[model samples]
Target: MGWPPASAAAAAAILCLGLLASAWAASAAAAAHGPRALAAVQPQPTTHGGLGPRSRHHRHAYAAMMYMGTPRDYEFYVAVRVMMRSLAKLGADADRVLIASADVPSDWVRAMREEDGMRVVIVENLRNPYEGNLGGMNRRFKLTLNKLYAWSLVDYERVVMIDSDNIFLHNTDELFQCGQFCAVFINPCYFHTGLFVLQPSMEVFKSMLHDLEIGRDNSDGADQGFLVGCFPDLLDKPLFHPPENGTKLNGTYRLPLGYQMDASYYYLKLHWHVPCGPNSVITFPSAPWFKPWYWWSWPILPLGLSWHKQRWDDLGYAAEIPVVLIELLMYIAIIAITRLARPQMTKLCYNRRPEKQGALVQGLIKLAAILAMVAAYTIPFFIIPCTVHPIIGWSLYLFGVLAFSSAVINAFLLPPLAVLTAWLGMVGMLFVMAYPWYHDGIARILVVVAYAFCSAPFLWASLVRVIDSLQTMLERDPYFPRLSEPAQETEFSKLF
Candidate 1:
């Protein structure tokens, strides 16, 4: 039997009360620790066992720009910080190297060299000789062409070049065992510039410069294209096999796909219910703003909120309760309003019975509703605390994209499990915010209130849908009644 609307509302209220009570308990537990306790709870950054005995001395290189004249200096600093942290966690015994133009700020160089414990290599004579096109538009490939300088680092026997936006999930120190010019086949039979192993030599570097001076047209107009042009036979190269038991190695090797899984796989695998086993690294090559360092970007991508938690730890920036409260309330309001309006919108968009109104009226209503939601949610971000508001707006924007895209695809209703997963994410975020160094006594109380006010109703509604869906599946009941059959007979027949 279906629940009455009044009963459902009451249940939601009870859930809210329960959440509030739990929040109070959590706050009390936190109070027991005293004022000085939060410092003890801040997670210590991972420290690497630098250069152990028998470890090969290979260097890892990252190419990035500071854009001196522009206002993107902070961008370079954060990227370098996250990359250095990831390297320190996984690149134990391996040398951390960065290649930047002379225009890069001295502060960035000092931070990487002294604070991050990386070797900063300054390339003063950097310039791009080749011009390339991006999406049929003419552009210079000079910035990308700088990656070629890694090959000129002949001081290192083997080098692993990675983009600054790439995050290491596991110790890829084992990639050094592979032969020269090893890379994964992720970008349409070509190697992704995110992570690749190469033997540094002056000869290869000089040859690449020669390719550039001669006006070699790399079809894609980037480093990846130039590299593909340089090695036309890379696709035909045999799979990489590491030398074992004193065996001799001869051919170029392809790195395992797990070493450089693209961010797209995170969502695709989840949609397919496929398990993404431990990856050696996860690369965010597209969209410079989508890097995981920013709290706003990572949550929209796949992977648990745990990834963001780890970043928060490294950053040591605890979001104020007001920030999280503002975020949670906005999300809850948006989700509740959207879900409530969906049925009417669906009927207006696709009515089984036609009305006198034309299609234009329906389209106009949808467009207005979308515009209203976007404005309502987006305007609040500007008012919230500057540091955390971007994350709040970003989260809402991504969900908005998902909702509208689903409508466009004619799959308006997400599966109950999918909705449940999203609800759980909201709940998990609140709890993460409750941890030490993240909240004060008053902030903790505010968190509890926010949880009760926002998460409770949303959770209750999602749970109702999930339970109803599961019960229907198990009972094998018809989801719709036949209009052709008599209503009295249909109701009476069920008694049999």
Candidate 2:
């Protein structure tokens, strides 16, 4: 019995060595080929289906493009995640696909795949043939030609290519049953490319590439104009009505106006009144600055709240909170230090005699001071992240202004009220834009214009006051009190 037990132990040791050898070999291969090798062999969680070879059978996909050409790329990434998460929550029976540029960070791609349950297709940024011809075209559309990659996604039977600015109010799975190509006419003549259905075909994709290479008559040098050029006859096509039997249509068709309800429409009636077809999606095809994801767009465009709500419900602001909190803390520290150490900062000012400086030099100095105050107000606005929560965004902005304005006040010995007029005006302007009882967008715009007109004189008065105060301080017998002298506490220091 002892001999038999020893033999069994030897066999177990041999088996253990074999398993270790296999694991070591796999790890070595992964080390040699890098993360892609590991990604290939890694077993994905069952909730997120494996990225193995997809079935050749027809499938449907909801696709959007993410390219890194713009300053607001991160904001758009957040928007795309919210949109994809919304589609997943709506129980849409289609793959959520992101056509990302090759340069998109690996971690972002991994996060979208693992966290958002998205299939990412990495593609090269398509070159715009009309780059030189772009006279009045929006330069942001330079990489938009990459949208043509949608046609290269030949794995899907039907692909609904959508812009990130879209908020899905309802399931759009029925769009797959419409046709090989279908788009809504948000404008009278041109179809809106914000959301459009297309049947992916390599042959068609190649043809498009050929057309692009040959310098085909693309009006706007963007995907919208290029596609419009390709399908010029879409306006005349019959309207699409999804067949109850679920049969996919063959030809191009015009999707109902309701499919791409412009957000502007809701502002007109203060509610959705699109009776053309099912009001499934809302698109912000207006000015680029007014995209719904922006925190400032809320209340100005009431529909923006809906998009924010979706973002909150689906992809919470957890990722943004850390940065926002850090910024808040930094601003608070700046304000506190500036207030407590005002005397020390004031001592740093120049002490040149009034006779030494020429009139032109003094005038230039005052102008420079005014410009510095302007920079203090405007710089903070651009530095803050674009898509943070409105509460956090506005609060950070206010704190940032105060901190910078305080520094300006201490350095120049200017009156605080004159220096802070811009901050106060900004606050008042926000309230004006957010007034809820406006009859329509036009009324709201007119009211804002009128408010600006009314406030102009006051602003000018503040500017003049700032200049006069600066002139007085510069021409004083002693420009700033000597550091050797006893510190005299002024009203500014007392208030702080």
Using all chains and alpha carbons, the TM-scores for the candidates as numbered come to: 0.53, 0.81
Give candidate 1 regions above 4 Å deviation. Answer: 1-73, 130-132, 135-142, 245-250, 271-278, 287-289, 304-306, 318-376, 379-496
* lDDT of candidates 1 onward, in order: 0.53, 0.75
The digit string of per-residue lDDT tens for model 1 on 286-405 reads 665555654455334433244445545565334334444544554454445455555443332322222333356435544543453344334433333222323554554455434333
Q: Model 2 off-target regions past 4 Å?
A: 1-52, 55-58, 135-139, 344-350, 479-496
Model 1 / residue 192 / CA error / Å: 1.3
- In model 2, the Cα lDDT at residue 313 comes to 82
Per-residue lDDT tens digits for candidate 2, residues 429-478, read 98898787877777888888998998888889888999888888666554
Candidate 2 weakest lDDT stretch, 10 residues: 41-50
